[model samples]
Structures are given as C-alpha cells and as structure tokens.
Target: MDEAARLGLVERYIAAYNRFDVDGMLALLAPGIRFENHAGGQLTAQADGIDGFRQLAEHAAALFREREQRVIARRSEAGRVVVEIAYRGVLAADIADGPKAGSVLEMTGRSEFAFADGKIGLIVDRS
Candidate 1:
C-alpha cells in the first residue's frame, strides 16, 4: 500500500485500541498477524494469528479503564513503518505485584509495523 494508506490503517488500529474495541482492531489486522510486546528490553507478551491476537486484545481491554496512544511521529524505514508513540493508561484492576487500580501509567514507546496485503501483519511494540 501507499504511505498514506499504510499510515491510515495504523491510525485506525490505534483508534480502536484506545476505544478498547477488539473487533475493530482485529478488522485491520492480517489473518496471520503477529503481535509482540516488549518492556525493559524483555519480551513480555506475544500472539500469533488473528485468533491469538483477539484473545490477547480482549484480555487487555479489561486491564485498562482508560488508555490513549498518541502518535508522536511516523516514518518509512526499510520497507516498514516505524511509529513513535506516547502512551497513557489508567488501570481498572490491580496486578499482584504491579501498579494499583486507578494508578496512571505513562510511557513513551515505538512500534514497527509490517504490512501484508494492505493489512497489518506484524506489530512489534517496544517501551
């Protein structure tokens, strides 16, 4: 896809994510989509294919009462789109040893997007 179309697709995914709309987000993903989440230089979670991603997305929706991922910038790099993001979230439930409910989580992250047939195929998120 062209750069504009690619960016639009990614933006749509982000919009769905902020809305916690799993199906909306899934619609923009390729059937064989791969998702990876990284934190503190460690791989935290991942899902392969639409079914796996859907489960992950649904579970995540319950963790955050509110969340936003604003695009800071985006650029084409080596046949992929790299997006700089500013993220904020308010937890809806507490983890055993993690942040408490109602706590604000803030971070800056970047995501690398790989497209397959005009849909998002691979997403590698780092924070």
Candidate 2:
C-alpha cells in the first residue's frame, strides 16, 4: 500500500479499537494476522488470525467500562506503520485475574504494524 493508504489503515484500526468495534478492526486485517502485546519488555498476549484477535478484543472490552486510544504520532515506511499512542480506560469491575475493578488506567504505548495486500498482517504493541 502507499503511504496515505497505510496511514489511513492504521488510523481506522485505532479508531475501531477505541470504539471496541471488533468486526471493524478485523476488516482491516489480512487473513491469519498475528498480534502480540508486550509490557515491561515481556510478551503478555499473542493472537493469530481473525478468531484469535476477536477473542482477545472481547476479553479486553469486557474488562473496561470504556477505553480510548489516541494517536500521538505516526510514521509509515517500508510496509510498516509505527504509532505512538496514549490510552485511557476505566475498569468495569475488579478483575479476578488482573487489575482491581473501578480503577482507571492511563498509559502511553507504541505499536508497529506490518502490512500485506493492503491490510494489516502483523501487529506488535509495546508499553
């Protein structure tokens, strides 16, 4: 994809994620897309393909009462898009396996996206 299209894809993807629109997000991804999340320099989650990504997104949506991610900066080059992001969310409840409920979480992170056939083929998030 060209630079404009690549950037548009990333922006739309982030918008979908902020809205918790799993289908919308999936529509921008290629088949068998790979997604991974890293925190503190350790891999926290991994998903493969549409189904896997949907499951992960659902779990995330369930955990937060509301979530939003804003793009701080973005760069597209060589079939990859790198984005700096600011995230904020409110917890829905005390998570049995995670953070306490009613807590607000805010953080900054960066994500890298690799494109194939004009769709996202891989995503790596770091925070």
Candidate 3:
C-alpha cells in the first residue's frame, strides 16, 4: 500500500480501539499479525488469523473498563507509524478475583505499527 493508505489504516485502527470496536480493529490487522507490549510483558504472538485477533480483543475488553483513551500524537516514518496515547480507565474486577477493579488510573504509552497490505502486521508498545 502507499504511504497515505498505510497511514489511513493506522488511523482507522486507533479509532476502532478508542471506540472499543473489536471487530473493526481486528479487520485492520494482517492474518499473521503480532502484537506485543514490552513493558507489560504481554505478547499476542502471530495471532493465527482474523478470528484469533478478535478473540484477543474480546478478552482484552473484558479486562478493562475504559473511560477514555486518546491519541496524543502520531507520526509515520520508515514504513512504520508511531503513536503516543493517553488513557484513563479502571479495572473491571479484583486483580486476585479476576481482573483488578479500582479508581481510574491515567497512563501514557507509545505504540509502533508496522504496516503491510494496508493493515498492521506488527505492533510494539511501551509505556
């Protein structure tokens, strides 16, 4: 895909995530997409396909109750898109019980996206 198309796809992915649109977000990933959160020690290794991506998204949504998540900045370079985001949200349940539930906490994180075929092929995130 051209650079413009790639950037547009990245924007769509962010929009879908902010809206908690699991299906929409998954649609913007390649079949063998890999998502990683280095700081959190989390990785969704080569989510087999779109179906697998959807499953991951569903599981993630069930863990957090996001009040708001916004992209503070985004830039594209060397065939990759980088985004800085600010998020405020609360856990859905107790950490030991299931998922931790508590007052909203603010977080800032950066995500790097590698685009291919007008979709995200790899995502590396850090806080």
Error of 1 at 24 (Å): 0.6
Q: For model 1, give the RMSD to the true fold.
A: 0.7
Candidate 3 lDDT over 1-127, as tens digits, reads 7778877887888788868899888888888787766656555343556776677778767767775557899888898888898877787756664535875668898889896676788888776
Q: lDDT of all predictions, in order shown? A: 0.95, 0.92, 0.76
Score every model by TM-score. Answer: 0.97, 0.95, 0.81
Supply every candidate's count of residue pairs whose N, Cα or C atoms clash at under 3 angstroms.
Answer: 0, 2, 2
Pick by lDDT: which candidate is best?
Answer: 1
**Order of the predicted models by lDDT, top scorer first:** 1, 2, 3
Instruction: List where candidate 3 sits over 4 angstroms from the true fold.
Output: 40-48, 97-100
Q: What is the lDDT of residue 46 in candidate 1?
A: 100
Q: lDDT by residue for model 2 over 1-127, one digit each (tens)?
A: 6889888998999999998898999999999899999999999999999899999988888888889999999987677899999999999979778789889999999999998888999999999
The full ranking of all candidates by TM-score, starting with the best, is 1, 2, 3
lDDT score, candidate 2, position 106: 97
Residue 63, model 3, lDDT: 65
- Writing each residue's lDDT as its tens digit, candidate 1 over 1-127 gives 8888888999999999999999999999999999999999999999999999999999989999999999999998766889999999999999789899999999999999999998999999999
Candidate 1 runs further than 4 Å off: none
